[model samples]
Target: MAKDSSFDIVSKVDMPEVTNAIQQAQRELEQRFDFKNSKSSIDLESDKIILVSDDDFKLSNVVDILESKLVKRGVSLRALDYGKVQPASGNTVKQEVKLVQGIAQDKSKLVIKAIKDSKIKVTASIQGDEIRVSGKNKDDLQAVIALLRKEDFGIELQFINFR
Candidate 1:
């Protein structure tokens, strides 16, 4: 009997890259003319990033700079869930950017549904935060990968552990 071909779909972010992005953004913030003498700052916590600025406009600029750095470092913006700006101490506006590390439950359901609806000869099962797709035919597995690539799952999906 032939073993099944399989691959895992996951949404993962490289924390080191995120850290580098934050450092670059901070460096740029310090040098930007507009931010000079401003209290704009970006801080990375365990699973989230904190952005604080003197006002809403500055906060937005901070977010843009961080996003550009993240993109340049090959980090998907989708992995960062933005929170609403709120007032912080010292009259600064603050925003929390949550880092998404895995395929959410709703998103997992969507992945399974899309595969089932495609009527492809394969099976998709959710294992914790990742989805495992398997089939007897390698061609079918490739087809499923193509199908998933065309669909927007709202988050960045990576195909890994292929066999």
Candidate 2:
């Protein structure tokens, strides 16, 4: 008998990197002239980020700055599921950016479908927010990974736990 080669596909974000990006964005918000009087602010909660600004224009600018900081910190923009800007108390606008940490059921189905459709000699199974792919040949596993990379799943996927 031979051991199966396998890898897990997961959508994970490094919280420390997110924290650093938020801190950098906050510093820029405090120092930037445009944001000085705009009263723009960013707050990171357990699984979401809160952005507050005086208006929609400033709110978008705040998001852009945060996104740039996040990119600099190697955080993919796809990890963020942004909410619509809504009016808050005192006429301020607030937007909630939710952090996506796992593969949803629909996405998992897509992954499985893609792998099966590709006719690759591999098996993919969903393992609670992650996909486990295994094959007798390591080359087949690598091909599956490459095939998945070429598809746009609307989220940042990471391949890990290879064995």
Candidate 3:
């Protein structure tokens, strides 16, 4: 009998990187000529990022800065679920960007289905916030990973715990 090779698929973010990106965006916001008197701000909340500015245009600029910082830190833009820009106090606009940190139930199901439909000999089981995929062959496991990577699950996925 042969042992099964396996790996775990998970959606997670490096908090330290996210924090560093936020700090960098903040510094840039403070020094940017257009934002100096615009009262633009980018705040990192518990699980969401808040962008505030005098209007939608400035708010979008703040988001662009934050996204660039995140990209430079190797974070995926898909990990951010942006909300609508809404009116705030004093004629300001605010936008909430939710950080996607876990694989939702439906998304996990989609992953499993994709693997199954790929005709690859692998078993994918959802484990809490992650998915465990096991197969008899390492090449099959690699194939599974490649297949998953070709699809957009709307969340940033990391493959770990290969054994």
- Per-residue lDDT over 29-99 for candidate 3, one digit per residue giving the tens place of the 0 to 100 score: 98988987787888888989999999878887888899999999999999999999898998899999999
TM-score of each: 0.98, 0.98, 0.96
lDDT of 3 at 12: 93
Ranking by TM-score: 1, 2, 3
- lDDT tens digits, residues 32-95, model 2? 9987777789999999999999999999899999999999999999999999888998889999
Better candidate number, 2 or 3, judged by TM-score? 2
lDDT, candidates in the order shown: 0.96, 0.95, 0.92
Ranking according to lDDT, highest score first: 1, 2, 3
Best by lDDT: 1
Candidate 2, clashing residue pairs? none
List, residue by residue over 2-69, the lDDT tens digit for candidate 1: 99999999999999999999999999999999999999999999999999999999998999999999
Which 10 consecutive residues of model 3 have the lowest summed lDDT?
35-44
lDDT, candidate 3, at 26: 94
Provide the RMSD of all predictions against the true structure, rounded to 1 decimal: 0.6, 0.7, 1.0
